[model samples]
Structure formats: C-alpha cells, structure tokens
Target chain A: MRQILHILTQPNDPLAAKIIAAQRQEPDHQVRVADLTVPEADYHALLQEIFSSDSIEVW
Target chain B: MKPSWLLIITSDPRTSARPAEAIRIAAGVGTWKKADVSVYLRGPAVLALSEFADEFIDEDNYTRYFPIIGEFGRPIYVEQGAPRLAEIGESPMRYQEISDVELAALAARHNHVARF
Candidate 1:
C-alpha cells in the first residue's frame, strides 16, 4: 500500500515546490500540497489519511 | 546551528499564504528561542523573494525582498522559484533545481510540513 505524506498544508507557492524537493523517501510515498485557496474538506481529508497510517504525530 | 525542522516555502506563510490571528508561532528568531531556521523558496511564493522590496524607481531599478531577509538575518533559498520571479537577472537568494521526484523525497524527510 502507498502512503501519502501531506505537506500540502506547508506549501503556498515556491515553498510547496521547495518542500516537494526536500521531502519524501521511497517510491510508494506521496506528498500533497495546496495554495492560497484550498477547500477545507480536502485539507481535512489529507490529515485523516495520515492518521490512518501506522501512526500520525504532529510536533 | 539550532535543530532546524526545515522551512520550505517562498513567502512568509503567515502573511502570504495562510492568514491567521497572527499567532501560529514561527520556529524561533523573532520572538522565540531555540529555533533553528532553514527556509527554501519555490513556486509562486518565490515571487516573495522580491516581495515587499523597496524599489528606488529613482535608481536604475531594484525591487526585491532579499534586502529585508538580509536585515532579518534569515537563511532563505530560491530554486526554480527564482526564474519564476523574473524573466532574467540575478536574484538575491540562491536557486536550487527541484524536481517532482526530489520534492516527494523532501516531504518524507522532514519531521513536519506546514505551508503558509
């Protein structure tokens, strides 16, 4: 199963692209990002997706 | 250097992308201590590299946000985000060539990813 790492919350333009460059480890991983205008539901879904993973912790 | 968590974004997320009650807490420097800062700029926010820059339309021409960052002493980087800023010219920040493959990899490396 492929897991998605949601960095979408962190990117707002160049940063999103930058984060896209810096993160992610293996092939089965995915990174999602957003901009000035992202739907609330979509954002929440990203977090929920992570929680379903082996574990989800925000520090 | 402080234990930085990696700040990968173009403009100040607080003022540029996400607008909150002005209190999401940055990773040190301004009001906090023990915060290591490493910012990377790319995409649209890259435009912020020149954001809020003082342009002396009077002088030949100079409009960019680097001067402010320099004063603030924040270590920021610009990659493809630089070329997106202008057609051509030297930007104050250094540019890093990023790819989808690279971005995906970075997301997994950081402890957390918070876009503004």
Candidate 2:
C-alpha cells in the first residue's frame, strides 16, 4: 500500500529516527517521509501531496 | 529584528505535538531575535497552558518548555470564549484573556504574523 509519513520534527530528532526505522521494517509499504522542520519545506504543498495519497500518518 | 511577532497557534497538543513545538520554537526565536513575541491560543490550543498537558503526550514533552518560553517575557494569551478554557481548569502559566476582536487587533499591530 502507498503510505505517506508526515513528521513535523527536526532532521536529527530522535522521534524522526525512530519513524525512519519503523518505516524500514515495512518494506512492502511504499512510504514517503516529509519533514516539516526543514527551513525550506513547504508544509501546505506537502499536506496536499499526503492527502492525495492512499494513506497518511503524521508524527 | 522585527518590532513584534504574533504567533497564532490553533492546534491542540493532545492531538499532535507540532503545535506545542511550534510555540516553543517561535517563542525562542522571537526572544533571541529581540522581537516582542505574543502567542495567541484559540480552539484546542488552550490546552497547552493547562497543568494536564504533560499527560496527553508521551514524547517530546512540549509542556516542560512552555515555562522557559514564558521566562523570556513573551506574553501568551487565550481567546476569551475558547471552549478548551472550560475543559482545562486554571492555567499553570500566566496569560491574558482576549476576545476574538482583540486578537485581530493584536495581529494587526504586529509586524509579522504566523499561524500553526
């Protein structure tokens, strides 16, 4: 299944690391990680992409 | 540095950690940047000021950082008619009560405005 993981955290945050590890275990799921903490990240655009996907989980 | 900043946070910390984190970052940045920072809480965001805030989140402990932000002298305000104000008893931190009209006026006076 296509899944989008939207994480509103810094690049090096521990929570973000844990999320990346968890996503790796689900190899069958097509996952995209959007980090909102990045200065250049456009949250509205990312939200649009995530809402259009099959499934979305925010952290 | 900007003269003032208005950070309007409408997200409930119980539902997500982003709102609390946004408040923390905004307050810190505003303080360090020497701008007069004001936080306006509306909707569920008022919960961030409650003593029970720590119980809702397991990670990121955003409630703990709230006091540090307050120490910077950045004022935090809650909407006068926000429903969450009734849900969560007395606030642990200091905040002024402002009506929706006053919130708009506050925003208008600030040089920069951000919403989360």
Best by TM-score: 2
What's the TM-score of chain B for every model shown?
0.48, 0.83
- What are the models' TM-scores? 0.44, 0.59
The digit string of per-residue lDDT tens for model 1 on B7-112 reads 4553443234331111123422333445443445565555444433332221111222233334435445445434556833455554455555554454454444
DockQ of each: 0.22, 0.02
Please provide, for model 1 over A1-59, each residue's C-alpha lDDT reduced to its tens digit, 9 standing for 90 to 100.
Answer: 33434433333444345444544445555544333255554656665666654212121
What are the RMSD figures for all models against the true structure? 8.1, 14.0
lDDT of 1 at B30: 30
- Candidate 1's DockQ is 0.22
Q: Provide the TM-score of chain A alone for each candidate, in the order shown.
A: 0.36, 0.60
Overall local distance difference test of candidate 1: 0.42
Error of 2 at B28 (Å): 2.0
Model 1: how far is B45 from its true place, Å? 1.4
The window of 10 residues in a row where model 2 chain B has the poorest summed lDDT is B54-63
